[model samples]
Target: MSQLTIVGLGPGPRQQLTAEADAILQSGQPLYLRTQVHPLTADLPAFTSFDSLYEESADFADVYNGIVTRVLATLADGPVVYAVPGHPMVGEQTVAKLIPQAKAAGHTVRVVPGVSALEALYASLAIDPSAGLLILDALTVTPETLQPTLPTIILQVYLPRIAADLKLTLLERYPDDHAVTMVQAAGDPDVERSETGPISQIDRLGWIDHLTSLYVPPTDETVEYEPDGESIDGMVRLVDTVAYLRSPEGCPWDQEQTHKSLTRYVLEEAYEVVTAIEGDSPDAIEDELGDLLLQVVLQSQIAKEAGEFDIDSVAARQAAKLIRRHPHVFGDQVADDSETVLVQWEEIKATERAAQARVLDGVALALPSLVRADKIQRRAARVGFDWPDVQGIWDKVAEEVTEVQAAITSGSKPAIQDELGDLLFAVVNVARYLNVEPEEALRQATMKFTERFHRMEAAAKAAGQDLSAITLAEWDRFWNAAKGR
Candidate 1:
């Protein structure tokens, strides 16, 4: 039977090669190497290497596929010995693809393991892998795959551009000034090199090559990895903190709170976030957003204790809803503009609300009256029960204003209230047609009026006159002065 033997070249030193692998290389059989880039390849017996395929292929996948095809074709001739750098099983794409295919072709396969790069890395860095460690590929690094709370080792940082891309992804979770270590030729003392510096300068190192790897230690100030199953990421740490606050040994006020009791705080925090955004201070916005997020985590914790749901489920459900509704982004649906996106969004929402008894049923009644009116008007407009244009809405506002004057002249309290509400609703419709949020517009108007009134009060105090005792003409004068200032 034709035999296929896979051997490891051990990390770069001749001493690290296994005795079993050395015996096979010296057996004078047909020898093949995955690449000739390693230090040990110079002293080895005559062999054929697939290094030329790397230059001819477009990508690593094509190179790996080409290597596997040549190796399997060579195996059909006679017994063969295939050697790859480090351990044959560790990050060797060609070896992984060749073994099963060779076995299926009625060939006996044997793997002789040698010292892997990970073993040499541990010895070079003097770090224990028993602690939490996250190993990632530089080519495939992503925000979702990174865990900054654990000591991470990134492999295959073969090029400067790959390192630069990895640095950007890491910067999302790790600070730019965070310390990182680069190691090259881990076990070979003759040519080994290691450097420690800020992650921001990783791509500037000129000595980086195919053998280089990066090490990022966990940042305790940003996020911590708890061995007791308490936390793994920043969000998980927040969830754990909230869970502890509701525990028996935790805060009394937090332990006594229910979901219903926390509703008011949720609304208050949301409004404070809006106020902070309006103030346009980054620090205030971040703080207020954290406060708002706390409410969500706390409510999720309460639900978890009640066996209802948790934060993970809430986030997953929301993610699913967003992906499902955004077919233009997540699917093949094409939406070129914001208006088209909104139309697609509403169509998706309408399908989700298909079980509802009415078009306006999902608009919460607890929303502010102006916001609720805007939502109600939008819902009606979707069903074609709306004015054709902004001009029609303006005409309706004038008609409602006339009715309010007639009702006030008739001296009917209910009639006046009804007409005033009609006029406000018509105005809200005009605001919606103009693409303005009525609630936010009214809030800005109210704030401006309050500021001007305070200025008028100051003017009255400076003139030694009580505001209540001022005549209409005097009030007008003060108001004009305030406006001018």
Candidate 2:
């Protein structure tokens, strides 16, 4: 037979206590109360309480562990009734941890339910929880854990310090003047008292104890985690983490970084992501992508601090752009192929920016020269200033190369530099005509050259000759060997 019985004391009122709980307490067996702090305990039969654990322990975990240890030890002798305030399963940390371990160790455990703070809170606040309600334990609460759009009830506000901590956390999401209700001795009509004021004054409510609970009303906007228990892919959690990092209590280095300061990091992370993708390692790509996302979040956090924008605004803008651009996917538009999609996308962009003065007005100056040149030529093509075909582009490349050769023969440095730039631009046009991104093509070409160069170095080392000491002819021999390999 099971020797352990867990029961709730029903929010400290004799009338509110359940018949089963009362019968168990009066069964003439060894009864143990978690604490003697409740109002209903005075009218009950004499029993041992674990109130001393609270005074002697270092933390709540220690106190709860001590209670569990004592309960398990006493259960070895005979059957015992363990009573706690409110429902045994609701905000009862000791019971939550104890029951599972006890049952697994061959002890039979039974729980008798009683009135929880949810019921008491509803009666006191006069609100329906069905609309949207978030129940949380105050001890483990944070701004990220809070769903601000739902009416929230936080239980186990057992100390003034905990209340102050909760108030600070709430201030991160709620305005300082946001109203909150503090209910004490819930469900006990004689001792039940309620106070309403700004959340900032939570610590000053004068009477905070195990029975106290806080009720927070919904805000104007919805929370990231909806009240329906659905998770939105962790975007909200990431946003909240970035916000906390930019807060006054956040890291000093993170707080000092502005949008301009983070630009270099953004560029570096983007390059790393490209490298990772090219390496064909999925784990590396995922890690590099996370780093790139950090740069975006950091910039948004800085912008939010300046009162300019936030992650949500950035996401909303991109979402709207995607919906607008993909008319075939989101609207009644037909695009049978990738080429048609590109044409429609460009047309949509042109219509959106009809007031632009120049064709290249939207092209960023910070883009790589090759990519910027490609964009410029594409934009110019839309305005009727491009080659008619790939042959024309090839001819242009040949003409630019001739000009560069003539400039070099004449020994004019400036003319040579100008002609070389024109040659590179012509090559970019050729790449574009071949339906390849010039910058990406160049990057791949460079990586291939680097691999061949390293192979040549390794061949030189295997031949017991350093490349620096070898002649140009010997270098060519190793280079040719690496090429053939």
Candidate 1: segments with Cα more than 4 A from true spot? 1-232, 406-415, 462-465
Please state the error at residue 473 of candidate 1 in Å: 1.9
The alpha-carbon deviation from the true structure for residue 177 of candidate 2, after best TM-score superposition, in angstroms, is: 22
Candidate 2: tens digits of C-alpha lDDT, residues 1-485: 45799999888788899998999988888989999988878888879999998778744556888999999889888888999988999989889988987898789999999998789889989989888899998856776678788899999787776686577668767877888999998888888998999988998878998789999999884334343324433555675667678665788988777777888898899999999999999999999999999998888766654435656668868999999999999999999999999999989999987898866798988788998999988888878887888999899899998999999999999999999999999999898778799998889889989999999999999999988999989988999998898
Candidate 2 Cα errors over 4 Å, as ranges: 1-233, 409-412
Return the top candidate by lDDT. Answer: 1
- The residue-level lDDT of candidate 1 at 308 comes to 53
- lDDT agreement with native, every candidate: 0.86, 0.84
State, as a TM-score between 0 and 1, how close model 1 is to the true structure: 0.51
lDDT of 1 by residue, 314-353 (tens): 8878999999988989999999999999999988988888
